[model samples]
Target: MDIQRYLQHIHFAGTPKANLHTLEQLHRCHMLAVPFENLSIIYHQGIHLTPAALFSKIVEHNRGGFCYELNRIFALLLQQIGFQVSFISGEIRARDGTFGPPFDHMALVVTLDQPYLVDVGFGDAFLTPLKIITSEQQPQASGTFHLEHDGDYYSLERRNGDRCSHAKTLYRFTLQPRQPEEFNGMCHYHCTSPQSHFTQKLVCSRPTENGRITLSESKLIITQDRQRKESTLHSHEERLAVLRHYFNIELNVQAA
Candidate 1:
């Protein structure tokens, strides 16, 4: 991959080094610039796991993607910039209080002064990488997150604030190194299976400087300073306009 071109695509201007500051900046820039979207699945455009395909779709075509596409490409960018990055498997926590299958999600572990959990594809997640320390709350603009360890697995949890009664567990992962191709099955499942959420709805979202904007189904929800305002999109033209205006995506597909 062309590292400079990729950096420009993500709007990362400075010279990147493999330090914590650079990592943080890159992560934040990526979260702001590249949205977390599943438009391809809705449009019947197949998801390809190759690096060329990812870079072409995200950078060349100016589009966004879900976890597998986003995290894999971001990992390649980090590796090219001299960071020690590894792919790790995560099982997402379902609403029924059960964890999904292993490799349900892909995340990164970047080793610098210490190992830090880095993820840009989990929509509305921590903007900067969280240090891999269990029980220590790592506060971010989005929310407060912490890692919980149980034997070989580590669970990432988030809470709105100290007043929140329960901490939501986003997903659980292990330190075991993974290969990008190993996630292909789950990626394909997400793109094709009826049980996967990607196949169920059209969601495109990204974080802004003060808040986040999301287009789910026919609703456009913008949250600023913790206040949310939602608008219902009535027509395909309106939905397309919202996608272009809010997420900077110009999709040619009809509503799914």
Candidate 2:
């Protein structure tokens, strides 16, 4: 990995040390610059989990990707910077109060003074790394996030605010270290299976300074200071324009 090029890709400057402060800055910078997108699936481009493929897509080509692609490459970057990082499997919690199968998602656990749950792939979620503490509300610009400990499993939960009626469980994960290849099956599933949401829609989103901008299918949704305004793309040219102007993605393929 060309560490300097990767840092330049994310616009990260200053000398980096494998400590909490550097980790936090790197995490935030990555989130702001790189989007959580699934255009590869939409365009019928294969999603490869290898480091070279991920780096080429995200850093070289100025593109973003889903969890498997984002998190795996991020883990490699962290390891190169001397951070002790490990891949972990997360079972996504669906709206129906059920959890998906193991390895439904990939997240990173970085150990500094303590372990921090670092995830850049989870769109519009926590911006900074969350310390691996139980039941402590970690308030972020995006939302109020917390973790619940259940024996060996830990559930990451989020709420709109303190006054929100209910907390939504984002995903449940264990601390058990995993290899990147362990997530291959689910990665392929997400890219190929019709049941996977990635295959069903076109989603390219990233967090801005105030809120988030999401290109979901033909709709362009921009949320700023908690106020959302949505507009529809009337044509493929309009959709392509939105992609370039807002998301900085210039694709040659026909819009979905």
Candidate 3:
């Protein structure tokens, strides 16, 4: 990996190599810098899975992407900076709530001094990687997350209140190395499937000084703890203006 490009993409500074400090730094940097976006997926371009291609599109082009693009790029940067990293795909349970096959989402299962579930692109996910061993409720800006291990698989559960909602058996991964190309089929499916959420909604999310700002379709939702607010966009101007006003994303992406 090109250190310069990695640094430039994530805007990492003060250190070049990966350390617990730098990892924490990079983790925060990634959370701030790169948005979890899927515009390219909606724009009719095939999602690129290779690290080289991922870097070219993200770092070189200044584009944001979905989980596959965001996490894949982050994984490479970690490796380039000398962190022990590995790739694994995640499966997203359907809204109707059924565990699909593993080709649902792409994620990473990282092993360091201890195991961690590191992902920067899940959008409003765990602020820091969840300690794989910690079953206690880990607090995040988004919500609370806890991991439960069952046999050989793990489930990531996210909750906002007493009610346990939005639980995704995120992914089941082993300590095995994965090539970027291995995610191509799933990536394509995510980008192309009409049943897929990405194909139906124009969504982008980022962390803000207060809480989080999420643009779904045309509605803007802002939440800081129990205080949640929303606005209904009536026109393109409203949508474009709202995106810039909050999330800092430009919808008018130029074509190649």
| lDDT for residue 164 in candidate 1, whole number 0-100 | 63
**TM value for model 1:** 0.98
Q: Give the TM-score of candidate 3.
A: 0.85
Q: Please provide TM-scores, in order, for all candidate models, with all chains considered together.
A: 0.98, 0.98, 0.85
> What is the lDDT for 159 in model 1?
89
Per-residue lDDT, model 2, residue 50, is 73
The models' CA-based lDDT, in order, is 0.92, 0.92, 0.72
| Alpha carbon lDDT at 195, candidate 1 | 91
Model 3 lowest lDDT segment of ten? 167-176
Which has the higher TM-score value, candidate number 2 or candidate number 3?
A: 2
Which stretches of candidate 2 lie above 4 Å from their native place?
Answer: none
Candidate 3 lDDT, 63-124, residue by residue in tens = 67888888888887788677888787676656666776664566776677887778887787
Tens digit per residue, CA lDDT, model 2, 1-256:
8999999989899988899989999999999999999998999989987778888899989999988988889999999999999999999998898999999999999998889999999887999999999857899998888899999999998888783648889999999999998999999999999999999999999999999999999999999999999999888888788889997888898766
Q: List the residue pairs that clash in candidate 1.
A: none
